[model samples]
Target: MLDRSESALRVVVRSKFYRSAFLALLIAGIGLSAATPQLTLFLVRDLGTPLPVAGLYYVTNLAAPVAGFLVGRWSDRSHDRLLWFRVCAVIGSVGWLAMAAAQTVWLPFVISTVALSLAGGSMAQLFAACRDELSRHPTKAENRVIATIRMAFTVGWILGPVLGSWFGGVFGLRALLVATAACVFAQMLPLGGQRVERYEDPGISPLPEGRRRLDHMMPLLVFTAICVLAMTGDTIKFGYLPIYMAEQLHVSDSVRGAVIGIQPLLELLMLPAVARLADRYGPLRIMTVGAALGLAGNIAYATSSSVGGLFLGQALTAGLWACVGALGVSIAQQLYPEGVGTASGIFLSSIPLGSAIGGAIGGIGVAIIGLPHVFFVPAGLTTLALVAFVVLTARLSVRMKA
Candidate 1:
């Protein structure tokens, strides 16, 4: 009876670890999404910046990827991943608070870089810690776990816009920013002082020294390239879709908000099924299908003439994003088991890198050609990603079979 009771206690404790991690991710997502959607608008309305300049402000978000990679690499070497998370959360909270107080453009710009980067780094560390914990347990399904995390993030995305709009409407953007800081600080409470056991796969043997470096580097490179392309296209759509709805379609702010909200809501519905499929069929295959969907969705966005068409485009994009969110991290963890933290950092960084490039290019495109035409660029980029994925996967399969 004592043994049985002890076993049950261990099980409960193990379950709590995963639950806490998921909750932290959910809260992080809420904080980020709440302020991000309105940042461009805030810059324009409050700071008197031009639309193009406001859009370009996202280019400064390059801090996220840079910090994500560095922190991830550090976590790989460090024994206590949660400690890094706590430090990052504190830094991010300070940054958000500062942003709330900033009256000048330069202060927000400089502070945002520090705050967002640290926050991103914290998320990367959290993911790496979760992956390590999953690996240690082995009974937990990685794809399912990843899917749950994605769903949590999707839920946050769903709530974030509503909260942002409500808080901004009721109080102001500064209040919304302050709320975001509070959310970031809240994550530390659940995750602080929690340490996860690290596990390295015993099945993988050391490669021959001559071929070792090349073989190790190739997978990371392939994963990074694919992620960069996918993120670039996605960020372009995310950054400019609102503007396109308002300026090109002459939609009301409420309509634009609804349209923006639809994608994540659909994603929340799709992620569970997508995770099941990814676990069964493999993340790489599902990711390919997702890339194709992204291409199609971008094309739809570029050509749509009616509100119905816009809805269809966003629906398809949501499905694609669900696949990416569910599968991408799982694939990264699988590919680089030893350096999960470093790989995750690299993978997470792709978002900011893509966002920076996408924002800069989208801003320029909007200035040169038109708002609707900017999506064409992502459509074209997605096509290239598809082509590369097909060719690379085919060769990889042949090698594996050999």
Candidate 2:
């Protein structure tokens, strides 16, 4: 009874701001989660697109980061995340609707690349608003807040594929797209009436675009690059792992599903704990450890194919992503505290950017070295990223001291 009560209490989010934000991300995640996995199949089965063309769909996702960065900068400059967020939500709705109505390959591709790309930034706005809200409602557990919000999104990812599979089989892909649009539209509801507490002074004008801020930010930008590289490994493993499972390991589809599903599930469970530890030990140190774990996981993939080996690899890689997905945005927000919108946007943008890079690298790796040895590529990339991160951090510290 006591344990159950504690667990129940642990799950509850007390703040209205947090609860609403959590709910909104969950909805958005569901909308995104459901559509994305089915897109290739939808193209092949519904649109009669060739497998090669469907495979190239990863290129279209590159638009999200580019569009989101612009949106994030716009929201920061305008100081009206609310308006832009709503506009994005509206755009997302229209984009999904357009996708659903698309009868030709060219039309849906255009909608995804253009409209959905713009719509993707709505999440950046949401993260920025949440950051702004906490400024008003101050909390020490900011990392926890971000992690819980991410956990909400993870939950949606877990459910989205399953629900999408069911709905696609039953009501059809068109209905799933319509439902995805509804989820996108509903994102605006949480923060629709919410407002930010903007600080301004009549005596002091805005800070000029100056050298000081750039010097301070350059290392953090380097840090963001490190994260993108680190995350790219996760994407590479994700894109190729199922193929690896079927081909190299001779694993059944069920086993492949379990292996593929393991990381997100473990990520959900580990995120808050990782967040708590991050607050204690520092996100930098924790994330560094996560990077190390990713490198280890990649080596595990390259080295062995036994069940125990696979489990260790999955468990460690989950730790890698748990750190990134849970803490990456918050780290960016903290680093660039003055421009939460822009910082959040940049962090959000890194994901699709990382995915695009990862997909390209994975494809090349498969061709060059064969699929069995491809994990070594990510292992090598993560090691290089970690070395660069250490060098950059040391330089930043030395410069600060001087």
Backbone clashes counted, model 1: 0
Where does candidate 2 stray beyond 4 Å? Answer: 1-12, 198-217, 393-402
- Tens digits of lDDT, candidate 1, 186-269: 987776567875555687553224577457746766876776776576676776787778777888988877777788889888
How good is model 1 by TM-score?
Answer: 0.88
User: What are the per-model C-alpha RMSD values against the true structure?
Assistant: 4.7, 4.4
Candidate 2 residue-wise lDDT, 1-402, digit = tens: 112112211333676656777888899988889988888888888899998888877778778766876787678777556667788889999999988888898888888888988887787777787777766655556667778888888999888888888988899998899999999999768755876544333443343367976765565577778887887776677777777778778888888888878888999999988877776666776778888888898888878766567777889999988999878887777666666676777778777878878888888998999765788988988898778756764554433211
Provide the clashing-pair count of each candidate structure.
Answer: 0, 0
True-vs-predicted CA distance for residue 394, candidate 1, Å: 2.9
Clashing pairs in 1: none
The alpha-carbon deviation from the true structure for residue 379 of candidate 2, after best TM-score superposition, in angstroms, is: 1.1
Instruction: Give me the overall lDDT of model 2.
Output: 0.77
